[model samples]
Target: MKIIQNFTDYHEKTPLALSIGMFDGVHLGHQSIIRKLNAISEKKNLESAVLTFWPHPRTIFNPNDDLKLLNTLDEKTYLLQKNGIRHLFLKEFDEAFRNLNGEEFVRQILVKKLNVKHLIVGYDHTFGKNKSGDFSLLRKMSDECGFKVEQVEAVDFHEKHISSTQIRNALAVGNVKEANEMLGYIYSVSGKVIDGKKIGRTIGYPTANISSDPLKLLPKKGAYIVEVFVKNRKYKGMLSIGTNPTVNGNSLSTEVYILDFNEDIYGEEISVNFRDFLHEEIKFENIEKLIERLDEDKKLTDNFIF
Candidate 1:
């Protein structure tokens, strides 16, 4: 997919069938809109396009909150590409852009910049100046502006609507199964393997410490069964997201122990896909107890694989 970083960079000849949102996690609900977008794009012979924001609007309004996002730019790009979008307009959200009203956003970004011939949005979607736009406003604008607009209804799972916020809440509680079910895929994070205290080596577990994006949301602090990807290979593993309380550490860390494998992966890039929540991180009474718990973890992880 072609990524258009700025409004000036947009130069598409074919008018676009577009959707706009943060698309955080690009969960099932977002996918419903995307699927409709692609169908309409193909049927109407327009370019499939998406206009997503960066740094999130919430991050801007609540600067002190350090609001975490579900997908990084790179991850979002890949997911959108897989969903069959042709053009991705990644607009930077700032105070000035936030000031645009619903009509202004339709005129400027949708009509002027993207030349959007068709627009698809989620059921609860809102845009422009305090989110004053909804399907009603969009339909009225479409009638006046000479473009087409569609609102895809929410995708309901087990009587609850699938949404990004719901998925984030699930992960926050270490409910990977629910999150992944709503996401329609494994929820994963990518980061650089950094040097740690080398404490795992002495215990014979030798973990690869991960330095993930600060803006990216992390799962609840606990042990988990995970799939690790490194050097273009996938491996089963157990991951920990918590402070090393047994070692008198107070800072939270993310590290994974690759099953039946050991190598120098420091400074390498790795991805971890959470599969199942294992146990809450425990502060063992002694080193021996910690080692014993780790052994049990390894067995459970191994059995999970087999």
Candidate 2:
């Protein structure tokens, strides 16, 4: 996909079938809109484009709130490109950009800048300052602007709409199975392997310490069944997320012990996909007790089907 960073000097001669949103997790609901865009673009022979904002609007509006995101910028970009997006337009949501009203945004950015022939938006999508723009406003202006507006109805899972916020809520409490069902893909975290206390090795279960992006939202502190991707190979593993209380550790950490695998993978980048929540972090009475729990975790992981 051709990524247009901001509406700086780029211009598309061909009319675009466009959709605009932050598309945070690019969850099922977001995908439905994109799929509609793809269908419309193919039918009308228009260029398919997704106009998204960077630095998340929440970050700019609510600076004090430490908001954790489901997917990083790179992850969102990859998902958009992989799922048949032809153009990805990124608008930096700074103070100056935030001041644009509904009419101004449509005229300056969509109609004039992108030459959007048709706009595909979600049912509850709103834009402009204070989110004053809505389907009614867009429909009213579509005639003069020489464009059409189509709204995708809410995509629901088990009666509730599948949303980024819902997915985040699921992850916050370590409900990865529910989150993945809503996401249409496994929830994963990617990072570089870092050195640790090597405590697992002492107990016959060596682990890879993953140091992920601080902005990445990690599942709740606990043990989980995971699929670890290392050097393009997949392995079943049990991941522990917590401070090692039995060892008097203070800082929280993520460590994954790959079953039946032994290798020095320090410094390599790896991705871990959470499958199921095993148990909450426990304060074992001693190292022997901790080892016993580790054995149970491994047994459960072995039986965990992908």
Candidate 3:
């Protein structure tokens, strides 16, 4: 997909069938809107595009609020591309850009710059300063600007609204199975393998430590049965998420010990998909006690495969 970082870089002459949103998790609701965009683009013979923002708007508007993200920029891009979006336009949500009125945003960015032929938006989508813009205003502006508008109804699952907040809450409480059900896939974390104290090796369960992205949200501290992917190969593993209380480490860490395998993987980028939560992290009395618990955890994790 062609990624336009700003409106200044949008030089395409062909009008685009566009959908605009934060699209944080790219969850099922976001997929519904993107699918509408794809269907419209195919019907109109126009390029499918998504206009999103960085700093998430909320982060800029409410700096004191804790903003945990479901996917990083690279992960969101990959998900958009997988959903048949051909163009991605990302705008930095800065103070200056935040002041644009609803109509001005439509005129300058959507209508003039992007030449959006059709806009697919969610039912509750709002924009402009103080979020004063709503679907009604967008439709009015689309009519005035001579463009088409498509409003997708909010998507629901199991009679409840499926949302990023709900998914995050599930993960925060260590409900990996519920989170995966809402996310349409296993909840995964990606990061670079980093150097760590080699204490796991001495205990017989060698581990690969990952320095997780600061922007990505982590699940509740616990041990989980997960599938580890490295260099295009998958391995069954048991992952611990905590501050390694057994070793008296004070810093929280995500460490994965690949079962039945051992090799140098430092500096390699890998992903761990959490399939099920095994148990909460506990502090062991000693190295021998920790080893015994690790052995039990491994046995419990062995019954599940991802």
Candidate 4:
């Protein structure tokens, strides 16, 4: 997909069919809207495009919240390209851009900038200052603005609506299965292997310390069955996200022990895909007890599949 970073940088040859949102996780609901957008674009012979924000608006408005994101910019770009989106207008969400009100946003951005001929939006999507823009506003101005607006009903699983917030909540509590179901893909984290205390090596379960994105949302502090991708190869593993209390450590760590694998992969970038939650992190009485628990975790991990 052609990624347009600034609103002024978007120069389209044909009228565009577009949807605007932060599209944080680009969960199943977001995918549904994108699919509909592509269909409309194809039928109208217009370019399928997405207008998204960077550095997430929440991080700006809620500066002290330390907002965590599901997919980083690179990951979101890859996913959008995989979904066959033709264009991506990724604009910075700074104070000046955030001040654009409903009508101004429509005239200056949707109509003037992107030449959007059709708009597909999630049922509850809202934009502009104080989020005053909604489906009703779009429909009311469609005729004057010379564009069509579509509001897709929320995609639900088991009668519950799928949303980025829902997915994030699931991950926050180590509900990987629920999160993945809503995401329509495995929930994964990527990082470079870093040096650690090397405590696991002494217990026959050497682990690779992961230095993941600080802004990425981490699953609950626990042990989980996971697949680690290293050098483009996937290996089954048991992953731990915790502060090593047994060793009097306080720093949170993400470490994975790849089953039946042994190699020095320090400084290499890797991805860890969570498949299942195994157990919660605990404060073992001693190193021997922790090792014993890990052995059991390995057996349980071996039988896990998702």
Candidate 5:
């Protein structure tokens, strides 16, 4: 997918079938809208495009609040690419951009600038100043702007709508299975391997330390069954997300011990896909107790299915 960021000259002549949102996690609900865009693009021979915003509106509007996102900017792009969209337009959500009202946004950005021929949105889609834009507003504007509009109904799981916020809540509590159900895929964290205290190495289990984007939301401090990606190859692993209290450590860390794997990977990029919550981080009475728990975690990681 071609990624057009803010300040990038966007001069595509071909009309676009577009869906617009921040799409933080690109969860199931967002995927439904993209699927509609794909179908419409194929039918009308329009370019499948998504207009997403960065700096998250929340970060712009509520700078004081701590903001943790399900996917980093790059991770969101990678997931969206898997949907087969042709274009990914990233608009910067800044003070200047926030002032445009619904009508102005439609006229200046959508109708004139992007030449959006067909618009696809979610059931609860809203945009523009004060978020006054809705399905009703889009329907009204489509007629005036000489374009088509469609809204995909809420995609639900177990009677609850699948949403990025819901997925975040699940991850916040280390409910990765529930989060993955809503996301339609495994939740992952991509980071560069970094040198650490090497505490795990002294034990039988050696771990690779990960340095991730600070804004990236991590699962609750605990152990997890994970699939690790290294050098284009995959391995099963057990990940720990917490301070090593057993060793009197103070700082939190994301460390993973890959099964049957032992090669220096520090400074290399890797991704860990969370599968399930294995257990909570415990400050065991001694290092030996921690080792026992690590052995148990390895067994669980090895036998994990689906």
Candidate 6:
């Protein structure tokens, strides 16, 4: 997909059938909207596009809160492209953008600038200054501007609405199995592998330490059975997320130990997909005790693997 960083960068000759939102997780609900967008684009022979904000509007408005992102920009782009979106406009949500009023945004940006042929939005989507724009306002603007507006209802699973917030909550509680069920895929963390104190190596379980995106939402601190992807190969692994209490507990880290594997992965980019939470991280009495528990973790992980 062609990724346009700003609305001004949109120079496509074809008018766009667009979906607008901060499609954080690209969860089932978001996918439903995107599917509708694709159908509209196909029917109209227009480009399928998405408009999303960077740094998330929430991160800007609430800077002090721990802003955890479900997907990084790269990850979001990949998911959108996989779902048939041909263009993406990733706008930087800054002070100037915060000032655009609802009508001004619709008239100047969506209509005059993007030449949006049709718009697909989530049922509860709101936009413009102070989030004053809603489906009603969008419909009004679309009617005046000669464009169509489509609102997709929230997707539900067993009476629960599927949302990024819900997915994050599940992961925060170490419910990877349930989180994956909602996400329609395994919950993954992608990052570059970095150097770490060779403590795991000393204990015969050499690990590849990964540096997570600062803005990415992390699952709860615990050990988990996971699949590690490096060099396009997926390997069974045990991942740990915690501040090692047994060893001072000064710094928190996410480290993966590939089962029966030994290879230098420093500087390599990898993604780890959490399959299930193994156990809570705890302080062991000694190295021997830690090794014993790790051994048990390995056996437990093996049983859970497909």
lDDT of 2 by residue, 1-306 (tens): 898897786965779999999898899999999999999999999999999988788888889989988889899999999889999999899877799988888888889888999999998999999887889989999999999999999999989999999999999899999999999999999999999999889989999999998888999999999999999999999998999898999998999999878899999999999999999989999999999999998999999889
lDDT for residue 224 in candidate 1, whole number 0-100: 95
lDDT of each: 0.89, 0.92, 0.88, 0.91, 0.90, 0.88
Candidate 1 has a TM-score of 0.97
- Candidate 6 segments whose C-alpha is farther than 4 A from its true place: none
Worst 10 residues of 1 by lDDT: 5-14
In model 1, where do residues sit more than 4 Å from their true spots?
none
Q: Over the stretch 1-306, how does candidate 4's per-residue lDDT look in tens digits? A: 888888575566569999988888888999999999989988999889999998888878888987899998899998988887999999999777899988889888899888889999998989989987888899998899999999999999878899888999999999999999999999999999999999989889899999999989999999999999999998999999999899988999999999989999999999999899988889999988998999899999888764
Error of 3 at 178 (Å): 1.3
TM-score against truth, every candidate:
0.97, 0.98, 0.96, 0.98, 0.97, 0.96
Candidate 4 residue runs with Cα over 4 Å from true position: none
How do the candidates rank by lDDT, highest first?
2, 4, 5, 1, 3, 6
Model 5, total clashes: 0
lDDT, model 3, position 293: 84
Tell me which of candidates 1 and 6 scores higher on TM-score: 1
Q: Where is the poorest 10-residue window by lDDT in model 5?
A: 5-14
- TM-score of model number 5: 0.97
Deviation (Å) of 235 in candidate 1: 1.1
How many residue pairs of model 6 clash at the backbone?
0
Error of 6 at 306 (Å): 3.3
- Candidate of highest lDDT: 2
Candidate 3 clashing pairs, residues 3+ apart or interchain? none
The C-alpha RMSD in Å for every predicted model, in order, reads: 1.3, 0.9, 1.4, 1.0, 1.2, 1.3
lDDT of 1 by residue, 39-155 (tens): 999999998999988768777787798688789988999999999999988888876788999889888878877788899988888999978878888899897787998889999
